[model samples]
Target: MEYKWIALSNTTIGVLMAAINGTIIIISLPAIFRGIDINPLTSFQYLLWILMGYNIVTATLLVSFGRLSDIYGRVRLYNLGFLIFTIGSILLFLTPNTGDLGAIELISFRIVQGIGGAFLFANSAAIITDAFPAKERGKALGINQIAALAGSLIGLILGGILSVYYWRYVFLVSVPVGIFGTAWSYLKLKELGLRSKGEGIDWAGNTAFGLGLILLLIGVTYGLMPYGSSQTGWTDPYVMASMISGAALLVSFVFIERKVKYPMFRLELFKNRMFAAGNIASLLRSFAYGGLMIMIVIFLQGIWLPLHGYSYSETPFWAGVYTIPLMLGFVAMGPISGWLSDKYGSRFLATLGMVIVGIGFLLLTTLPYNFNYTEFALMLFFMGLGNGMFASPNTASIMNSVPAKYRGTASGMRSTLQNAGQTASIALFFTIVILSLESSLPTALATAVTNAGAPQLVPLVHNVPVTGALFAAFLGYDPVKALLANVPSNLIPATAIHIMEQRTWFPTAIAPAFMGALRNAFYIGGIMTFIAAIASALRGKRVIAEEKEEKEVIKNA
Candidate 1:
């Protein structure tokens, strides 16, 4: 009944919806391709766009929208986000075309949803900070962060379930939730946060920042696809130009922000130790763990599940089911960590979390492809616990360190870093995997094909594009089937064809190579997380600017 609780619940719903949409498409990509009558192998561009467009749009807009919310009202912008997200969901569910047109429509609509998500993510923490007292913000944000994690967790399972019936159901599920959140936010939420009156929009800074990030993320997205003779497009001229131009523009944005009268990004805020270190640590942690779930999913759906007798189509669902320990660990520790941070400072608790995560990553590197389920589950739970411990307190420290008037901008800056780190993390992870694969995959494939009684086809399968293989694994496709699609069956023996097509053969063959690459990724991730732990430790002490401001208000009164 209280205003604070009202604000918390509404923002939680908004975050939950946004986070759910963020991940729902990943597990359901195969079904979505089927629904639109598109072949993913030939249309890899569409797949990349569908997967990365939403996040690209969201990351690009957060700082601008957050600044807008500061100039206008956080509550007003948040309500608009809800409405737009709902509209995007509706359009996605009612997609009218098939083939390339349908895929294009889906990507465009998801961008619309990303725009809406930007608004919600940019303002939710600011709104919560506004409504709750300083002492209670950690606990409040902890619950909010839990909603985000839970939504992601639920989306995986939900996408698996919904895709079994219809791909449209994946999008349809969000419609009702979006409608409810939109109506509730518009009617019940109030403008509790301060608005920086008369501040003009810094269009120059925004344009530079937005365009810069867009180009950079686009480069990263395309860098995953095959180009010319390379397994990845990192060396493509266009990719290189885009990345160079993006970095240049971002540098220009920094200069433009410094000169502007009312800059959208308040860079000066980073001077505070808590703000700077917290954000840096947050970015590092995100970079370390962002692609972790997908990596695990690929392991499960591509190698582990299939070798264990699960069909390719069945792997997606069971993969989601098996990873339940990850969500459970986060759910168990999130609130407790928040409460602890509120009593003691974030420095110790948050740093310790990243250390634990680093340990988990190290533990994962030891796992063989045929790892025991108990060991795998325990590792997942351990990492989840570490992430849960770090997320809430780190967020709380960032929000609390800023002045009240700039909370929206601060929140936006924080979200932008976090999102950008995640995008970069995915790029980094794929690059490492693809490169590792290139060195050994050809030899492994040739050997496997020869052993499978298809020595004649070994040349064809030997130079298989690593990206396609990774995507097939990710989507739970039979890699052998896709590879042998155009090969004349008459040339190969029927017995050999049957052997190669067996669910276990391809998985078992690829497992050794894939697992080796995966271990390299884990080692890199562990090192990054340990660096994040050092950053978290360097955050010094917690500083709640609100408490200082409150005392000043009392003194004036």
Candidate 2:
């Protein structure tokens, strides 16, 4: 009934909705492609767009939305976000085309949803900080962050279940929640946060920053796609041009911010030790873990589950089911860590969390492709606990360091870095995997075909596109089947044909190569998280802004 509780509950719903949509499409992609009558193997561009578009838009817009909320009103923008997001969901659910058109429509609608998500993400933390007292912010933020993580995990399972009956249900499920949230937010949420009364929007800075980030993220997304002879497009002229131009624009944005009267980005905020270190640590942690869930899901769907006798159709649901331990660990530790941080400083708990997460990544490398379920589950749970411990305390430290009038801008900057880091992580990690596969997968495929008494078909299947193979793994399709679709029956014996056709053969053959590539990713992730731990340690001590202000006033008096 209290205003703070009201703010917390509404923002939690907004965050949960935004986070759920972020991941819901991933597990449901196979079914979505089927529903739209599109062949995923031949539609890699559509797949990439569908997967990355929402994140790209959300990441690009958060800072601007945050700045705007500071000038206008946080609650007003947040309510608009809820309404826009609901509209996007409705459009996606009622998609009226098929094939390429359908995929394009879906991508367009998702971008709309991303716009709304940016608004919600940019303001939620600021709203929460404004509503709660300084000492209680950690607990409030912890619950909020927990909703984000839980929503992502819940989206995976929910998508898997709903997609079984109809793909449209995936989008449909968000509609009622969105409608209710929109109405509730508009009616009950108040403009309680301080606002900058007359700061004009810095259009020049906003343009440069938004366009720059858009170009950079788009370049990264395409960089994961195949370009001519290369397995990845990092060297393509267009990709290079986009990235270079994007970098130039971002540099210009920095200068523009320096000269502007009312800049969108609050660069001066970085001078604060707590704010700087907390944000840097948050970005590194996000970079380290963003693609991790997807990678694990791929391992389960493409290899482990299939080799263990689960059908391709069943892999999606089971993959979601098996990851529950990670969620459980997060739920258990989130509140406890928040409460602890409120009593002590965030420095110790936050640093310890990154250390634990780093260790979990390293321990993951020890598992073989056919790792025992118990070991795998425990490792996942361990990583989840580390994330739960870090998220809230770190967020609380960052929000509490800034002045009240700038909380919206600060929150936006934080969300932007976090989202951008995640988007880049997925692109970078996927590229790493694809490059690894390029060198090793062809030989492995050739050898597997020869051993299966299909030497005649070796050359045909050997040079399969690495991107296609990776997509197959993500989509739960058998790459070998698609590769051998055109082969004459007479060219291969019946027994060999049957052997290659079994659901287990390709998974068995690819596991060794895939695991090797995956281990490389894990090693890099471990190193990144460890560096994040160092950053977290560098946050020094927690300083509450209001308390410091009060002390300054007393001394002056």
Candidate 3:
């Protein structure tokens, strides 16, 4: 109890490390690919594996970890988590391979990092709860949440800088922090809450949920890959089958959890209105927020930043820099919202935050795909601010609405929704963008290429797939240019061929197709954001009213 501050500090470090690593790899992916000498275009599966592998491990392990934390000492599991995460980071920095082997090693390394992240995520909240009293818990959690968000943006910027300067520095950044935090937590964080021993491990529930989530995530990840020349693979028999089976298994997992004596996922938590509503809103909010970040990254690194004179390599760093507005919004409003929720209730803040995000989304739509940089920055800043506003208060509401004993399960449940929502969002947005691009890109290119000069060869050009065109832009590659030497000298002006090779041209050429896709995706995102906000507002009001009524009854007694 005396080491509460140390507990908070240690867990914060753990959470921050995990959160940053989540997307640090994203911005640094170009360098990561290069360091290992893998071309993301031809190596598209590697890209999916690299990205999906981390999420799969974290998502798969969270519930089991949470349940174990409840039975075993949270501090014990937490210390082990730190060690695991640190080892993962060390291995990643020491990656010693190239090409396919290198890519596989990187994916394997990332999966290990995810295991570390799952440990940190699984127990950070429970530790915080143990360290802080109920009322003070929100403040502590708010600070932790803000750090996590701030770390994400920081990771973006850090990854960009480190990856640009030296690829290993990206992973190396975590080494010392992990060491210090791990040592400190082992020394300081005490096991105080939910140290129950009666409930045994729910092996069936763990296996079922983990497998189900993993299979579903893999299906979703690969589902983004073009199937037989189709832009999106919704119709891919394999993708469809994986998805159906995954869903069925997950449904069965739910049943398994209910029957199990010690369930990792406590299905009964939903009976709490505040818990249920908060989770619903959390999932939807994540659904909106998840893809938005990637879309914004693509918008900046893939398009806007490059269009505005920044190099492709420089775009990631700047993209992170530009995204600080969201962090600013979070830092500014998160504590206040948490405090206010502690007073007036979470409903208002949650609802208002959602509305703010919704407005921000609407603002995004009005700007042309190639709009004024200042206006674009302004809109993004507001959007970040809006999302920050919603996340903290909504999370606090979800946690606060449940009973003390249910807190562990409640947190896990909430996080699961969030994690799952985000994963789905990425798949959803990516699908939309790719599918839209696939439809019209070929015609546009054919006309554009022909207009530039030499008759486009029917066989050579036709043999080129639309998926290649889409991936060329998506992974920031141009498959055509990669094979430019083969083209005849008469394919028009030499300048035209040169233009095709530049980074700006790919994004600009695909702008018409990409812009529509971007707009449509944001529109959907905006609607989802607002829906989450409404749910947030509605949940807090009902929960607060019920608690007040219960308090009055106790007072009368």
What's model 3's lDDT at 292? Answer: 87
Each prediction's Cα RMSD? 1.2, 0.9, 2.8
Q: lDDT per residue, candidate 2, 341-442, as tens digits? A: 899979998999999999999999999998899999999999999999999999999999999999999999999999999999999789888889898988
The numbered model that scores best in TM-score is 2
Minimal lDDT window, size 10, model 3 = 470-479
TM-score of each: 0.98, 0.99, 0.93
If the candidates were sorted by their TM-score against the true structure, best first, what order would they fall in? 2, 1, 3
lDDT of each: 0.92, 0.92, 0.76
**CA lDDT of 278 in candidate 3?**
82
- Candidate 1 local lDDT, 1-557, one digit each (tens): 99999999999999999998988898999999999999897899999899889989999999999999999999999999999999999999999999989999999999999999999999999999999987788888989998998898788899999999999999999999999999999999999888899989999999999999999999999999899998999899999999999999999999999999999999999899999999999999989998898889988999999989999888888888899898888888888888898989789889999999999999999999999999999999998899889999999999999999899999999999999999889888888999999978888888888898889988797779988898898897888889888899999988889889988888888889999999999999999999999999999878999777889899999
How displaced is residue 337 in candidate 3, in Å? 1.1
Q: RMSD of candidate 2 to the true fold?
A: 0.9
lDDT of 3 by residue, 226-317 (tens): 77756667888888888888898899998998787878888887876777778888888888888887888777666676677776556778
